[model samples]
Target: MTLRKPPIPRLLLNNVSCMRNAQQILRHVNVSVHDGGALVLKGTNGSGKTTFLRMLAGFTRPSAGEILWNGHNITESGVFHQYKLHLNWLSLKDAIKEKFTVLDNVQWFEILEGKQGKSMAAIELMGLGRLAKEKARMLSMGQRKRLQLARLLAIDRPIWLLDEPSVALDDEGVKLLEYIIKEHRKKGGIVIVATHLPIEMEDPMVVRLPPRFPRRMTLVDMLDRSGLD
Candidate 1:
């Protein structure tokens, strides 16, 4: 009898493009990542960073192109839902209930996902154990961001999709986020982050989106505005 190695996880985007209301957001974007890898998305405002991330999360459909997971097309209806089970998407919104306490929010997530006793460990890891009982409404912006990030630890998903994850995080909070990402990658997990803040990662693959075209101006108008004398 011979032992075999486990298959490596992979994600690929083939000439992906997205359109919203007839306006192209992303154009012919392509990227690929394997397990234990990280991909960072860099783009200017309106350059479709969020839109592309949403498409990867299956929350939005791409106007063109295909998203593949482990060599399988994820855009297919049945495949998408199944693939989503292994993904964790943290959007710009905090997604915490104002009325719930810090620990309560995480506990609720665990309960809803049928995961018991998995909340406290994650809360503590995110440095929220001290504020466990504090209502989310009372926590500071940085604290709230940490609370939101704790979900990643609690959920145990292999793929993490974060948009502007460091929005309100302070220096320490940013460090915590980095630590979490590093550990996740070490465990053969995949991470994709859309951020403007600097993140410390080892050999991260970058996808830079070009700036969107100015809709209100024509070629002649752009030249006239160039101030060439």
Candidate 2:
């Protein structure tokens, strides 16, 4: 008898495109990432980085093309929820409850994800151990961001989709973020980050979205179309 290696997990974007109000934000984007890999999205403002991440999270439908997970079409299979379980997404918003304590917030996420126990280990990993009992509202913007990133450690997911992760982070905080990402990749995990700041990684795959011409839309209209209004 012979032993065989298990198949590696993968995420594929095939000619993916996104449109808002009849205007194209992203056009014919293609990418492929396997286990233990990293993909970086670099672009100027309004270049569809956020839109690409949102599409991967299934928050919005793409106007054209397909997104595949391990070679299966996620949208076509109607398994979005199941697909989500295998990945974690950190958007621009921290999504933290101000009333909850640092530790409580992490615990809440664990419970919501059907996971048990607290995430003290993750809390410490993010350098929030001393503030574990402090209310989320008391923490600084950078601390709150660290707390959000800590949730990734609590949940064992194979894929990570991050948007502007380094925003508001200090030099030390940025270093910590880099360490976490590298460690995650070493453990056979996949990471995709969209950021304006630089992130140090070993030969990461890069995708650059071309800048789009600004459309004549009000601030309110843009917010509404982005589902943020």
lDDT of 1: 0.88
Clashes of each: 0, 0
lDDT of each: 0.88, 0.87
Q: Candidate 2, residues 1-229: lDDT per residue as tens digits?
A: 9989866448888998889667787789888888899999899977888987888888878899988887887896467767888989998888899999999999888888898654898899889999999999999999999998888788768899999999988999899999999999999899999987899998799988888877678999989989993
Residue ranges of candidate 2 with Cα displaced over 4 Å = 1-9, 215-229
Off by over 4 Å in 1: 1-9, 215-229
By how many angstroms RMSD does model 2 differ from the true structure?
Answer: 6.6
Model 1 worst lDDT window (10 residues): 5-14
